[model samples]
Target: MIHFDMSIFIVAAFLVFTLLVGICFSRQKTTFREYAVGNKQFTTATLVFTVLATLYGGGGLVRNVEYVYRIGLWWIVIMLLSSFGLWAVGRLALRMGPFMQHFSMAETIGNILW
Candidate 1:
């Protein structure tokens, strides 16, 4: 008797489930501003976790774990760059400055609405 490996199947199933959930909640008719900054649906905790995740890349995460396991609490210095990068991206992603647009977000942005 031969046994079959289903690891790939399990991963694919999980990915499909997650994608379905994302598709279900994602808005189809969102404007440029709304799509960029969201509708303020995120809680403070959620925002914090998102920022943390974005700031700490995969390498940083693994390195931090390794650092903690090997040395002491010194690798925290890496957080400075991460936090700065997150701040910059967050500002750009959230703050919408005045730009050339003769119509609404839906009608002007990407020209899909226009």
Candidate 2:
């Protein structure tokens, strides 16, 4: 009598499925512009939310809450200072908006260099 672990079979099946999907959907030749920005136009609010989500995703919110509970309320002041830094960055980004017509920092730098 032989015993097989069904979990291994399930894991292998999932990996194979994911690989097949990647191969089917991936482009053979992707331009840098397309790869970087997907040639998509996003509204200001959408871009803001996307940035916020990236910053706070992956247990960041939970970890911050835990730190507040263990460390004290002063952690919130630090968070606010970090947010002020983000505000400064936003101002710089706005100033650079004209130079980023292609929406890629590398492209803008290359153009400036050459």
Candidate 3:
């Protein structure tokens, strides 16, 4: 006899659904422009949120928390400085986007040097 648990079934169904969605999306090839700038229709608020997530996602927030816990307020100051640096780089990239067009970052740098 097989036993079925409702909680386990729900989790398994969700995992399968997510796996299918990933597989479906993975089958499509992203063009260089789409890969570089994404959909390009993101509003200012969306762009801000995306940038914030990119900057602080992955283990970045965790590492920042650890640094603050270990080193105190100065760690937050350092993070603020780095965030400002990221903003400057983003601004520079926006200015350079027209020149680079659909080029990847590595390709853009190569074109500049070579």
Top model number, lDDT = 2
> Tens digits of per-residue lDDT for model 2 on 3-107?
989999999999999999889879577877777777766788998899989999969999999999987778988887889888888888787756856666687
10 residues in a row with least lDDT, candidate 2? 96-105
Ranked by TM-score, the better of candidates 1 and 2 is 2
Task: Evaluate model 1: give its lDDT.
Answer: 0.70
Candidate 2 Cα outliers beyond 4 Å, as residue runs = 1-10, 27-31, 43-46
Please give the RMSD of candidate 3 to the true structure. Answer: 4.3
Number of clashing pairs per prediction, in order: 0, 0, 0
Please provide, for model 3 over 1-114, each residue's C-alpha lDDT reduced to its tens digit, 9 standing for 90 to 100: 888889999999999999999999999999867776875767999978988898789698889889999999999888777778877887887887556454566776777788
lDDT per model, in order? 0.70, 0.83, 0.82
Highest TM-score: which candidate?
2
Summarize candidate 1's per-residue lDDT along 72-101 as a digit string, tens digits. 555566555557865787788664544333
Q: Which ten residues in a row have the lowest lDDT in candidate 3?
A: 96-105
TM-score of 1: 0.44
Instruction: Give the higher-lDDT candidate: 2 or 3.
Output: 2
> TM-score for all predictions?
0.44, 0.69, 0.57
